[model samples]
Target: MIQKSIFYTSILLIVVFISSGFKPYDNQIDKWFDLDNTDEALYIFPSQKNTDYTYLNAPFKGKFFVGYKEAIGFKESQNKYRKVNTLGYMGKYQFGAETLKSIGISDSLHFLNNPRLQEKAFVTLLSRNKFILQDYINKYEGKVISNIKITESGILAAAHLGGAGSVIKFFKSNGERRVKDEYGTSVRSYLKEFAGYETKNIPAIKNAKI
Candidate 1:
């Protein structure tokens, strides 16, 4: 009788536990990989799409290999080049030759100035994209950028250029190597005023116009 009672109690507890949908470990870790990477998350040009279409636009050079599993699971980057896995993975996100071929070089650039290159890239993107400004802002407001240049030091950003009635803010790094504001103020302060957020790293270069 005692054994039967214990067995029934155990069964009842198990049923209750199952029915409760109780996860002993909160799935906080699952969110480490932001599965839904929006267009904003995409800062690298000559991306997979560009590479895939390289046949039409030959001489492409920006081919990033993005598998469904890895892309969905990317967490944070280590220093700059490597997107360190919060779960399990290693190595920098590799770009392919075809991808590189799709991106046309900036003939107008003479040097690789980060801010200047960033401005150029953003301007080009804005001019070519079919989406509205508001939609672009909403999607890309806080996303980081990466891999548009030849090296790990190639990160760039498109910050809000402040104007009348615009509450937008930008942020600059608060260190000795920080940039300057349009008004000659520290870039850190200027960006903060405009609520500018961080984006991925890209190489800043200046090329002469072709």
Candidate 2:
């Protein structure tokens, strides 16, 4: 009786092992272990079906052009699409009436309401300013003035704050001229604060249209 019971127990263990081997293949945990070259074996490839939030997860601005634009926009109006300041600067980058018109936007109401147009205006203005200040940028882009490093992005930001003319004047005076807006935000401050960002992707075009 003991020998028969032992023999039955051995048969049951063998059957259980074989059944486990025949079960469905579960790649849930092992799928991560599957390596590939596209994702460099680090993570699963992003598929439209399952992948969401492919944006760069960083919170603060980096050295990229997108980060540069978003950072300037945040400072201008906290990235508000329809924000209008007390001085009547419109949209995300806070363009004045004349500034809007300079970019071929005559309808202030349309510019104030249209976010896409406002964004285009910002980039277009950058291109225009870059063209206007090409001489100054070429002259003092890498130089240090008043303990502040002069850069293309800085010059463009200052131009946005005041104007391309102000940026040129500041550079011409060797950083001596301390021009300020109605709110007392100095061109020098914008130059220092917005220094060192990627803005070379914007081509220098005279009379850049929206």
TM, every model: 0.16, 0.71
Q: What is the lDDT of residue 71 in candidate 2?
A: 84
lDDT of 2 by residue, 1-210 (tens): 999999999999999998888855433322455455554334444444434545643347687888888888888898888998999997889999988877898999888888888889999999999999998889898899989999999999999999988887887788898889999999999999889999999999999988
Number of the predicted model whose TM-score against the real structure is largest: 2
Q: Which ten residues in a row have the lowest lDDT in candidate 2?
A: 25-34
Q: Model 1 Cα displacement at 167 (Å)?
A: 21
**Candidate 1 weakest ten by summed lDDT:** 147-156
Count of steric clashes across candidates, in order = 46, 0
- Per-residue lDDT of 45-104 in model 1, one digit per residue for the tens? 233344445363122223231221122122112212333234322222221222112234
Angstrom error at residue 21, model 1: 88
